[model samples]
Target: MTNNQRTEAVYIHIPFCTNKCFYCDFNSYVLKDQPVMDYLRALDHEMELTVKAHPPGAIKSIFVGGGTPTVLKPDEMEYFLHSVKRHFPVWSDDIEFSMEANPGTTDLEKLKVMREGGVNRISFGVQAFQNSLLSGIGRIHDTDDVYRSLDNARAAGFDNMSIDLMFGLPNQTLEMLAESVDKALELRLPHYSIYSLKVEENTLFHTMYQKNQLPLPDEEDELNMYLLLMERMKAAGYKQYEISNFAKPGYESRHNMTYWRNEDYYGLGAGAHGYINRQRHVNIKGVNPYNEAARTGLPRLESFEVSREEAMEDFLMVGLRVLDGISRTRFEQQFDASLDEVFKRPLSKMVSAGLLETTEDGYRLSSKGILFGNEVFAEFIGTLSAN
Candidate 1:
């Protein structure tokens, strides 16, 4: 019933931060001696120009994620949020507005500002509970700061909050992972996103990893961490809707579901990707280029088309990540080709290998395949009908 072309979700990327984390390679910069207000102005310009191309119909969810959205001063944040509200048309209902915050930077006053500015959900980057691990990961906020930040968020009347916790850090043990889970359960938020540490390119962690300075957990231990998290999350009455995300019923992230379900969404800000009107495009990464593009009333699109064959592959790949999988009726409607006709080989192989299973409504990844998803997905790659 939802209109994917006239998307109901939008993502705005804030690319400024106070400090970069050791493992972060996102397009965020240290806000030192930079024209912060000017960047906001450029972002505002981008929003206005970009929405003109798409039908800004009733947005159900808006997620402002970035280098650290809370790093903006109260007035700066006010301007930014207001800019978003002004440009994006919304449906007449309670909209889910979620923003990512860094713990050390967000305080009582700033959180209150966000709440008043129509932010209903807040996801804090409280990566770990131990101060030692926090420092090892190059996070400025310690355990105390995280506690204080959560308290501040609560006081600001933000109930639907989520905290991010990570496992598999350098030298992280099973005990430490348990402690993090226990600490998370104590706060008792409606949702939790638990991720394993990944050494990304151009990050300090990657350099340290190459030099053998970052002693990550062995493969078996890492697998143990995943197993432990799954068991604990289920025990805590949270559903493992996605590989790294757990949520209490009805508190699942609507914004993220837009991505995993392969629905259409508008991705604004530098280096953002969007899929609209059966075409996919990525915005320019350079701040200056994006600004100039916006000024010229043109989108800074690097690529413009996504093949129909590729779209079907994307549907399978992303839909398999969800617990409910894709709707067969919807697939038939979109492609005008039966799901079986389109992916007969891959589906048969997956089901035969016990990696995917056909349900009454559609197909879903099997439990074993959920644990080893990559191998299962790879079987579908080569055989896709080329557009």
Candidate 2:
């Protein structure tokens, strides 16, 4: 592959959790009785096959995500990290290797193992600061666990850290969210990802909504919670780099930026999704199935090519999610066509409606548009022809 086409980002999925969260819909299973070692071996096989097939560039970012990456024992973590280095050994000097951890899961020993194995950044799932709220949402960690986990990470020589907070949960009030934000800021972490609760199908929240048992905050309350967070984060000197993410200067999540910028990345392990050379594939989801499949070849459930028109739509949709918006230069470079010339109608319409504003070389969401970003993004999807 050419320099521009070689994948530089990787996403590895660790599909075992001590327990599933009530609101989670990710492809993760309970840790008990699962073939953890077998799964790791299968992941190693997948990495070997992936590099042989695609031949990665010097990887710039690698993100290890759910069910909870920290649930792995020290030995397991070491083996997994070794396998990663063996396959994609070449790394960018400033590579960001991040692993998602659940609070209360990472002790000093395990964290030391992680840091020694090359993980530099840690993102803890500290959903809420209140113990009551934490239990209500099925989180296994309390506020104390959050503090202890951060301390452990720091003691193990990690300075780049982030914590996640959630808003718009069941029984979550504006005051509650405000309190959570205050506690999260008190940690003085470099980054924060604050998101609203979404009741997706197959989740406990979804079932409760069907039975009218979920006492979620009203729409107006949820909007207030979002506004409060944006104002608080800004006042605290963190940039709202993305709608949901806040960072201190250079601490923005580079791995996630690869996705927002619509760049190619390798997705390894069970149930992971990868995009390479305009083609996307999702691996087999089940643990045993993935292990069995990887014994022979890539454990892909499905893979397909992405058309140019569809790719353009995706560029606008995800790129606009970033506060920087879409760059005409990048759009042209990727598709060899003028951004304005192709999407003139929607661009003109959104700009005229005060939802989008022109930048020096691109268009971004206006302050007003940021509140209704989903509506603005909707105007681009399915609007292009395959030709």
Candidate 3:
């Protein structure tokens, strides 16, 4: 409860993938000819240095994300997982250790290593069920690979599982999205994350969009697709915990909730960003540079202490992503100021515009607000001037 309390969550990033997806702008590289084991060792070294600097409490959640964490070989996976366990020795009894995997990369042996190494949750990157759509997005696996991977994961004793799906894809139809959804629901998995495609810079899709080559769904079609999916998910008994994530009861992603709840967590690996002790740090991005820097000390690209005002803004921006919204008491507890007093103007404007509604303990996005969430979040930015 003190200012110096350690964070209870850890995020380890593995920036290697079998192949780069056309739409992905994540900090990951193709696995071919990369220094995979060396990077893992450097990751281990980074963890040791980090723990020494900021000793952790019992970890509640640990998430391993990346281009494709499953791309690691069985021995490599064991070494990386062992390093994690060794560095963060203390763990809660119900700790949620999750890893991101690509459908084609994970096999039975690899899944067994992950399961035996204490990874209880496996989130597969099965972006679409249709083969053509998958290829259009530069995804390596087909629909059959998805089913096989799920079977292997279940055989590996991972009951807590999730899959990532996408809509608004280039050349994608609403009916295609519906088919993907129906297939996803057929599995009856514990969690499902369906996201709309975003054409971020430096990606293949971005170039296609620039040249007007990307056949994307128009605004009206995309909106209808969103509404349809929301209705389908609701009817299927999934809770839309966050704007882009849904889950069965008691199966929500605790590790991601740590980020949405705006709590501190350690970020390891190249290009990983971590916020701890009121400061945020981003590691060096290149593989060689990160490994070299780790030998000397913390491989930090940038580290800055977060100001109180910045923290409050971040709390509102990220915390509001959750459907439950921000708690007034918790805000006051965190900043020692009334949330209403600090953000009265924007809150009033948004509430009046029917974008935000008052909750018993806090404020949450109205139904319309969820649709235009970016607009609502924009109102909070730069409202409070630094004193």
lDDT of each: 0.84, 0.94, 0.92
Regions of model 2 farther than 4 Å from truth: 1-4, 385-387
lDDT of model 3 at position 246:
95
| Tens-place lDDT digits, model 3, residues 155-234 | 98999999999999988899999999999999999899999999999999999999999999999999999998999999
Task: After the best TM-score superposition of candidate 3, give how far the Cα of residue 173 lies from its true spot, in angstroms.
Answer: 0.8
The digit string of per-residue lDDT tens for model 1 on 304-368 reads: 77667877888888878887666788787767778888888889988998988889878988888
- Each model's TM-score? 0.95, 0.98, 0.99
TM-score of 2: 0.98
- For model 3, the run of ten residues with the poorest summed lDDT: 378-387
Clashes of each: 1, 0, 0
